[model samples]
Target: MPKAYVFTRYGGPETEAFVDVDRPSPGPGQLLVAVHAAGVNPVDWKQRTGYRRPGESDERVFPVVFGNEVSGVVEDIGDGVEGFAVGDAVFGTALAGGYTEYTLVPAAIAAHKPAELSHTAAATLPVAAATAYDGVRQLDLPSGATLLVTGAGGGVGAAAVQIARAFGLRVVGVASEGKKAFVESLGAEHVASGPGWAERARASAPDAVYDLVGGQVLAEAAELLTDRTKLITAGAPEEEVRRLGGARVARARNAAVLEEVARLVLKGDLDPHLTETFPLDRAGDALRTVEEGHARGKTVIEVTR
Candidate 1:
């Protein structure tokens, strides 16, 4: 049996608990990984609340684990799996949850963890950084074009800023005053998020916008773009974005996206900046850090040595 932090049922913190379960073996086209580090994302909490991502099925068994991205060494390989072998270092989105000592990763979504990347850094890529890469590449803003990112202080926002900068796009980032230097470090002009953020972003004259904060923030960011197609959001609902004449950032979740972000990390163009880490027993605290919106860039759980 292996220990895991999980939510017994769909609810809030009350539903989350620590439990033991049989170590999962990889099925066809999957790889079983000895977990080292796992990235904590907002979605982890959302999922605990019974909120499911689009395209995710309703069929799920509970005491579901609490992480999405994980990095570790391969322990076992499933039937038909290729390009991976036991003892190989790897990281990717988990097939179920990541807050455990061992978990299965579908071969199509996992990639080798490069020698240049540590488990902590590799853990951040599959979700936050990958989403940034996908959206920035999807927008494909022209060189010298300006891009605005709301909620620019968080994990996904910071990554978007750096990735957009690496591609030669001018970036304007909106965050709280406390994160000005952090956001600026990513090569984006920092705009304080508050009453007049829309005006501040307007001053930057963005040609495109990436909204990482939903609700009013998404609506406000919508004001900065004349071309709705040039506006995209990772935080808002499809109806909300559609009402504003824009669309959500369509994600291409695969090994290719993970590999691209890893390349960015190795090139020194993308740093996940994991500011905090918790051990397996304190996995709840790691999730709480991101859930409380107190984390700067990324938070992770170190599940093993």
Candidate 2:
């Protein structure tokens, strides 16, 4: 039996627990991975509170494990799988859950972990990095265009700033005053978040806004652009974005995108910015770091075998 951190039901941290469970077996087109590290995101806590993504099913079994992305070694391959094998290093969005000793990942979305990239770095890519890649590419702004990134201190925003810079675009990054240097280090003109932040951002005269903070922030960002079609958000719902004449990040959930992000990491264009890490037993602390909104960058859960 393997141990996993799970939320017994839809609720608060009270529902989360560490329990012994059978190791997951790979189904058709899935691969069983011995998880080395898992990325922590706000969605993990939101999911525990019963927040479901668009098109996600309402039905869920109790004691569901908590995680979305992972990096590890392949332990077994399922039927109809290709381009992978046992002992191969791999990372992807988890099919079961990532906060465990072993989990299943679909072959279509999984990618090989390059030798130079560590598992911790690879774990952060599948969700945050991939989302940034998709949204930036979706905007399709040309070189020299100014792109404004809200929540630029977090995992996805940091990646977006770097990726935009790599593509020869000018960047304006909005984050808290505390993250001024962090945001500036990523090659963006830093904007301090708070009252009148949007008004301050107006000077950049951004061609597009890549929003990671939704609600009022998304609404405010929308007002900056004359062409609302250039506005996109990963934090807000599609309906909310569309109401503002914008759209949600259209994810191309495939291994090809994963490989591209990995290449960016290797090329020194993007950094996962892993600010903190916790072992599997302290998974609660890891979740709290992100949930409390205090994390400067990405946080990871390292599983010790």
Candidate 3:
């Protein structure tokens, strides 16, 4: 049996409970990982509180595991799985079922963890990294283009800043004044406010723009972009993104982009900013930290030794 966090009812972090369950086995083309750390994301709380996707029915409603990204050593490999063996260290976002002592991951989605990163650091990469990579690619901005990132000190924003810089684009990151230095350290010129942040960004780079904040800032950015410039949002409200004339991205599509992100991390071009970690029993605390929305970077749940 393995310990896992499960929620029987929709509510805040308080509703989550850790319980013992039979260990899961990998099916064909899958690898069983002894989870060491799991990343906590906003989606975890959005789903738990039934806030983001209201009125939508979750097939895995009760007794659900909420984590997405997991980092660990492979304990077993199912028949037909190739290119992986037991004892391989790996990290990836599980489609579901990651906040457990063990998880089964599709071989195609799992990648070797970067040697430079610890399990805790690698655990922070998949979801945010993938979203950042896809957002950068969708924008397709040219070298020396000025890019604007909203929520620029958060997990996705920090990753976007680094990825955009790696692509040769100059970035202006919009964050709170408290986060200004943090954003600047990621290679972005810092603008210290959320609302009308794009306008301030235009002062530095008027030619190209990227809106990571979807509500008013995205709408404001839409006015500044020419047909040659592109606007893309990840981890922002989808309807507001469309209203702002920007494209909204799906998490699965972002997951597909993780392959590139994994390579970048291995090559030392991308870094995941992990700010805090809690044990699996303290998963509720982990969720609360992210819900506060002032975290400097990613928060994660450590599931095992």
Candidate 4:
């Protein structure tokens, strides 16, 4: 039996626990991975609290693992899988959960981890970086155009700012005052989040807005863009964005997107700096940090340790 940190039911941290279970076998189009590192996102904890995606079902699987993106060695190849080997270093969206020592990945979404990129960094890509890359491309802002990204200090927002800059777009990032330096380091003009952020962004005269913070921010950021087609959000509900004449972040959840993000990392265009790393035993604490919205960039669990 292998040990994994899982939530016994859909609830709070009290529903979570460490349990031993049989190692999962790869299914068709899947690969079993020896987990090395896993990224912690707000969604991980949100799902545990019974939050479901827009199209997701109301299904319950007890003792479910919590992680969504991970990096590790390929241990076994499933039927019909190609371009992957038994020992390949890979990273992708986890099919089961990533808190364990081993998990499964759908080959359609996984990519080979380049030798130059660390597993920890690779783990952060499948979700945050990939989403950022997709949303920026979806916006299709022209060169020299100014792009505004709200929630620009977190994992996905940081990647969005960098990738937008790499593509020749000027970026203005909104985050807490404490993260002004960090956001500016990613090549975006820092706009302190809180009162009057819209006015500060107006001072920059942005052509597009990529929002990672939802609610009223999405509505206000929408006002920044007259075209409305250029406004998108990964954090807000589709209906909310649509109400503002904007749209949700459209995802291309395939291996090609993963490869594109990896290339960006290798080309010095993007970085997934794991500001915090915790051992498997402290997985709960790791989730708490992100769940409480205290994570500056990204936090990951190193299961191999």
Highest lDDT: give the candidate number: 2
lDDT by residue for model 4 (1-305), tens: 78899999877889999999899999999999999999999889988988776777858678789899999999999999999999999999998899899999999999999999999889899999999999999998889999999999999999999999999999999999999999989999999999899988898888999999899888889888879988899988889898888898888999899999999999988878679999999999999998887888889999864
Using TM-score as the yardstick, the better of models 1 and 4 is: 1
Q: How do the residues 100-145 of candidate 2 rate in per-residue lDDT, one tens digit apiece? A: 8999999999999999999999999999999999999999999999
TM-score of candidate 1 versus the correct structure, residues matched by position: 0.98
Q: After superposition, how far is residue 186 of candidate 3 from its true place, in Å?
A: 0.9
Between prediction 2 and prediction 4, which has the larger lDDT? 2
Candidate 4: worst 10 consecutive residues by lDDT? 52-61
Where is model 2 poorest over a 10-residue stretch in terms of lDDT? 51-60
Q: Residue-wise lDDT of candidate 1 within 1-305, one digit each (tens)?
A: 89989999988899999898899988999999999999999889988887777677776798788889999999999999989999999999998889999999999999999998999889999999998998899888999999999999999999999999999999999999999999998899999999988987787888998989989999988888889898898898788899998888899989988888999899989989889998999998888899998999999899765
Runs in model 1 lying further than 4 Å from the true structure: none
**Candidate 3 per-residue C-alpha lDDT over 42-128 given as tens digits, one digit per residue, 9 for 90 to 100:** 777777766544235556647887787889999999899888889999888675567888988888788887676788988888877
What is residue 268's positional error in candidate 1, in angstroms? 0.7
User: How many times do residue backbones clash in model 2?
Assistant: 0
lDDT over C-alpha atoms for residue 165 of model 4 = 92
